[model samples]
Target chain A: MTALPMEAEILTRREESPGLFTLHLRLTDSAAQQAYRFRPGQFNMLYLYGVGEVPISIVSDPREARHIGHTIRAVGRVTRGLERLRPGDRLGLRGPFGNGWPLGDCEQRDVIVVTGGLGCAPVTGAVQYLMRRRERFGHVNIVQGVKHADDLLWREQYECWDRMPDTTVLIAADEAGPLWPWHVGRVTDLFDRLRFDPAQAIVLCCGPEGMMLAVAEQLQERGIAAERIWLSLERNMQCGIGLCGHCQLGPKFVCRDGPVFSWREIAPLLRVRGR
Target chain B: MATDCTLVAELRFLAAADRQRLIEALREAGYAVHGPRVQEGVIRYAPVERIEDLPRGWRDIQEPGRYRLRQTDENRLFAWAAPAASLKPLVFPPREILFHARRDADGRLRFEAADGAAPKLAVLGVRACDLAGLYLQDRHFLQGAHPDEAYRRRRRKLFLVAVHCAHPADTCFCAATGDGPVARYGFDLAISELEEGWLLEARSHAGQEILDALPTRAAGETQRKAAEAAFRQAAAAQRRRLPGGDLPARLGGRLDAELWQAVGRRCLACGNCTAVCPSCFCHAHVEETPLTGARTTRLRQWDSCFTAGHSLLHGRPVREDTASRYRQWLTHKLSGWHEQYGRSGCSGCGRCITWCPEGIDITAEAAAIAGEEA
Candidate 1:
């Protein structure tokens, strides 16, 4: 509950793309490391020694509580500084905060994960969870879209998922490059080719607000209930708890109430600009 | 929490001249006394060691964007409705270091939290509206699943002395909010000022002990009546009011109202109103690193929705314009607060109205959105 930072050492580091990197960290304190547990969509306040903190979604599987992995894009001041750290470098960590993706609710239903831009990181853990317990769930569909083909990461992982039974992976790029294998269009365009029973499908979406809104609208048009559609939101989450008041969407503090919320819960506020 | 009627019935009279004894008693009991005093033509909370430190014979005239202090021949203390600031600064400080991250010789980084112990504070001359604001702050910082450690440490050591507001100002509207003119509860001692003396009552066990130490007598029927009349007069003098009953729901339905754009044009987004607000609790984190590069401290300072950075996401503001920012502040205070804290965030103390550089009256704005006049 305390906002104070816990020391964490970077166990491993990987460059996923030109600007995107992944850091696998382990809490220096054995007790804290052993006690730590997180869900797919929950985020941690990652602090670089002399820099500041930023809310980064955990991308590693929840079952492996030993080391946590976060896929981060070097965009802002904090993340850019975090990108420079090596495997042995130390940083401050404070979370496992915000509500995560509703993996439990999708046990017997088909799960559709729609992501745009660099939004696939938060749901990567959920997809892995479903893959591990493939018998517990029905069909698993993941749709991702990026500005350019060069912007996409984890190409091998996507190819591997596409080969699995009862699992479907579709990727799109707005400005397609040479030898691009996926579709060349917006994420919403994927729905025209998508096949599923709306009544048995649970859609989870993340990305830019416009993309999420479009995704939700397309799902609604396909007869998906708003209650069955969830989204991971983004805001200025300085405090992982609700105290900072920066991540408010009307009455909901996105950090406390959700990074993941049903479309039914945020539909009223999402459309209202500046809410 | 409302004051018990039975507790008020047992009121004791403390003469106007004997008020210094109460301050002395609190000081002797290991409390640092802070009370209202005239500073720079405005009433502010400051250190008080003697009765003379209180703003006696000074009446504050408050209006939209204006606050003036006038001295009269009258000797009554606490003639003003409210001070420029609330007791929030004493508990939840405007800026505080959350923790310090330091690197040792072994290249190990360590985080140490700021000191948790706080001085025992006895704050006098608390008005009912401010008390209500503090109550909401209590629920916000202390009643949640993750209670704020710094705020909790300071709050537990506070000994409050409530002063009933006998003279409500033009901007006052605590009565409409059902908060006060008379002090209700949440104080160690409640005092109702009268022409001759003060009617004092103890609401807590510590307050009873403090009352027992002071030389006091049973209040005469006439004195009690005079105090009750003062309370009534204060309530009746308030000219500003907000539409009562289910304001949260009502404000929710008015999200698209055109009033927001109209007010946004005038709003400078200077954030003065929020700085003076008793109940607003938005803060932003900052990092401070010394030139020595030995340690960096993470501090939090008071922040407002009016600031673009408060809602920033990847260097872009979620609330891009003043209209939306204004709506966010207003709706969150009057509407979203109900969902988060189970009540309206505003205590109706009128500090925001009086301190706003543009003279943006919240009561009038709320009423306008409700299709009513100011």
Candidate 2:
């Protein structure tokens, strides 16, 4: 059977920022709820009646099998329709698709997460997972960047992450006022303030393509192998499966082969224009 | 398998009059037979009841941006290379309702999937490139991690009868692609037409049973030789051949070449190349809801890479200009496709060349790029 959206009810809705909200959904069918399980960095195709479907990453803790959480930003027609949804409203959902972050590979190794603006939503699940099993991993470093202080999401959660043992949270803004308590520069500048052995770290970065490319290049200059750096990419997705050729980035289908890929695999294609 | 090969070797001659009997046999075996017929002054695939429905004594002149049908005095069943349409529409409809949802009496929504069973269909006069295209589509829709239920249902009930091309079109390059002039596999029954009669060869158990039911006599050695010579002539007559050696790698390296901009100037981004392409399978989804808002139906339609919306990540499109979109289509088809599917995406059917309004030939573009690098 191909991807068909199942009816789901919104259990709760929380607004993290203006035009950005998180919905906790439960599949009406109990059997389907049990069948649907996702890993961190995987996404679901959320559908609204009379509107279209859009791919959103699952931010809920993976251990919770009953309720699925998705962070959505009102950017397009489908998302704008989704923004009007209330706690009791119903919606359609399919997937838990695409390859997720390689959590197992980070075991016994120091982990570094670099994100910008709304890019943190996709990797939030991975961060939560790592914190739950903190002893299994080494140093946990998260570096986030935003244009202004108001753009920061999950502020309370970032505070909680900082309290965890052996964890480091670094936040930066391009233009900061008195209210902001972080460095006033780009995310790459924060890398200078932190200290870590590049050989022992696995870097996971997601943001605009230009930002991610800059981060990857800087990390490579610091002696990190290209293979150890992983990045999450975004593209126009219609079908969550690989059949629809819309999400193609060179040979890889962002919807299927990845929304997450190692830098080594996509480096050549990234250099080409329009690819 | 050995027995089936021997059955194939036991060739039979099907006279022009006996072709009607074959259609009758197919209908009697619970299949709705479909074939090419003249519609809107052009030959198109449609339901057929008899041999008269075929495009008999008709041939087409196809060039870049031009197609014209001319009447011929000679009587032949399969003279055209292919119509504007391929097996794509039959298996993957242009628009299909994936499912429907409606509110129930309890104020909860109920969903039901689309119908699964499809009618048994026997399509006659399928060209070799179309047969190859069908196999390629099978690898995509059926062999994937999540098989397309609708495509699988329709494909399961299909019975293919392939016809060897005796007259290659001006835009045809199937000989270079190693896909045509003769049907190799993926067909139940294949036919090679000669001046005297049609030589029938069955390649499957079901095909053997159908051949047994038909009234046919053993094909003579002279008839077999004539069929072989005709296929050879068709292959030799091809005017276009893709440049040899590592096409995927060569095209990938030329992403910054100036040739794409020159081609993009003439290219209208009209999506006709992708629409006529036998292997293009991109699609977009749409939802329909009545004023009542009680029910919603989700449907999928064919999409093309030439459109600006094809690469929309958020509100912004990655390939915002015509040059980039054209480059994406060509690079994906000739170069990137090999990395993803382990095979070249183009079947070299030349439909893109003939149907292109700007007369842009892929073979010529590839040659120009390849020659510059060499």
Candidate 3:
């Protein structure tokens, strides 16, 4: 409900993952402070001032609120404009909007966060939250896939997760060079290797729409209920509010209603979802 | 005390000479007085410098079968609406610079949104249909999630002076959408043209003062009845009806009805329908930064959903064929708009129904969809 005009500033910028770059920003006014009140799975509109704005999910954890980090890919004009920004540059920003990942539901449940490509951005927010409260849940698992070894993001973070006592990190790629030691195939291949019971897991998945649909079906086949699997949708977010009529996936505003929703809540909308 | 059925009988009427005086007064009052004046053959919205300049002896003949500019003996400036154009571009603008990015000599970047200029426009003779269009577009632009700053700036600065329609064009269906031919809310004043001058009524404080300052009048009940009857008859004459108010909700259940493919064969996809509509407010923003770093600006251009490029992604347009695009357009107008904004996006101005290159009429289309559904 906080409606502030987007501030244009680039506090710091660097490429972190394949096709994914991170910008650590010192925003106009109290962007850092307001970011904490942001829930995981929320999004913000990044404006390149003269270029216009594009909605991006906040990749960094809300608990680490000194600055905001967005793991963005160069997609359209405005994002490409954001990617071109260097350290100390200024870019416009609005929100911390959208109903993000439901952290409260995952508190006592076994967690499985599956992600692919740059779809990892919104899930990254939830992943950070889970990492901070590591002791609260049992059987924490992360399964990731990308086009190539270079396409995988968050190398250091995944390495750290791999080393965590109760956490299991499994990654796959379509084709592998000598650098990849993990499995070779699609993300769905990793689902068969998991030993956890789906009834006890709160599954959070983000990635290509086709991949997510297939994974959701796999989870269903493994007897996982629709309510347990959450998805971060990729749709047009022109206004990042309930207006503009651009970001409608059925009746839901991906900006205000959700950038994150249960697979169940959106089953009726999927026929027209991805576009 | 005679119940004053005087329906603003004591209200002032502007003399033919007073329009010139009013424009000068508005200029003095810091408002840009814009009214309908004949340029070529049509009466268009523009600045009025003289009383004679405002469209006199002109009327617009609109129909599903036809639309044209015709001459009438009436000298009322508010005689017709929106000749094939809505007041959308004047506020949101057809093309606007939304932001700019410039890389300085040291390679530092900066972004700035264009606030644009605010002209305190006194928009004269806006009809109820276009006002509804403005409100619906506001849902698309200003009322949704984030505010469209440039749109908000121009919209907030406007001083509306509306004129009630004394008649309805065959193409006009304002009655069906509840946006009657009579000018309604968000107007500072409403002007009803009469045999002599006009029945000028003020709803806001600015309107009262403007009328108070202009050449004045006091009237009997007869003139007031005439004005009310004129509005009612004009509203009644609207030929296009959406079966009933449930047209939108009913159409929601028929998304894949064969009527879409039925109409698809004739659509040219020229997008003249969207351009002429009062409520279509889609736009796209592109960043343009020159190689010299002189300026990198984000330009917001009027975009139509009918265009293949509007829905393009990953080098593929979503609605490549005309059928899907036309379906999105009509369904959005008749259904998707209500689902999102809680109201129909169409004002039933019939601009889209008339201006099609192939004459793809929407009223006939809706009737077909409903007829087949039944």
- TM agreement with the true structure for every prediction: 0.98, 0.97, 0.85
Once fitted onto the true fold, the runs of candidate 3 whose alpha carbons sit more than 4 angstroms away are: A1-39, A44-55, A72-97, A147-150, A154-201, A217-228, A237-246, A251-253, A273-275, B1-25, B64-66, B112-117, B243-245, B370-374
For candidate 2, the per-residue lDDT at B354 reads: 87
TM-score of chain A of each: 0.98, 0.98, 0.93
DockQ of each: 0.77, 0.72, 0.29
True contacts kept of each: 0.76, 0.70, 0.20
Worst 10 residues of 3 chain A by lDDT: A1-10
Docking outcome class, model 3: acceptable
Where is model 1 more than 4 Å wrong at Cα? B1-7
Best model number under lDDT:
1
| Residue lDDT tens for model 2, B1-374 | 00011124667898877889889989999999999898997777899998889988889888888788988877797888778788999998888888888876554767779777899999998998888788878877888788898999899899999888888889987788888878888888888887656889898887888888988899988887777777777887887878778988887778888888888898999999988888888888878998987888888889989998899777777888777888888877787768767777777788898889998988898888766421
Residue-pair clashes per candidate: 0, 0, 18
- How much is A69 displaced in model 3, in angstroms? 3.7
Q: What is the lDDT of candidate 2?
A: 0.85
Top candidate on TM-score is 1
- Candidate rank order under TM-score: 1, 2, 3
Candidate 3 residue-wise lDDT, B1-374, digit = tens: 01111134355666554666666766777898777777766556778766677777777876654567877887666667556677786787777776566656764455555656788888777887888888887776767546677778788888777777776777777777777667667787777777677777888888777777777676446777887787777777766766555776666566667777778788878888877787877666556756665667666566787777665644466566777778778877887678778888788788887777676778778877766321
Q: State the TM-score of the second chain for every model.
A: 0.97, 0.95, 0.91
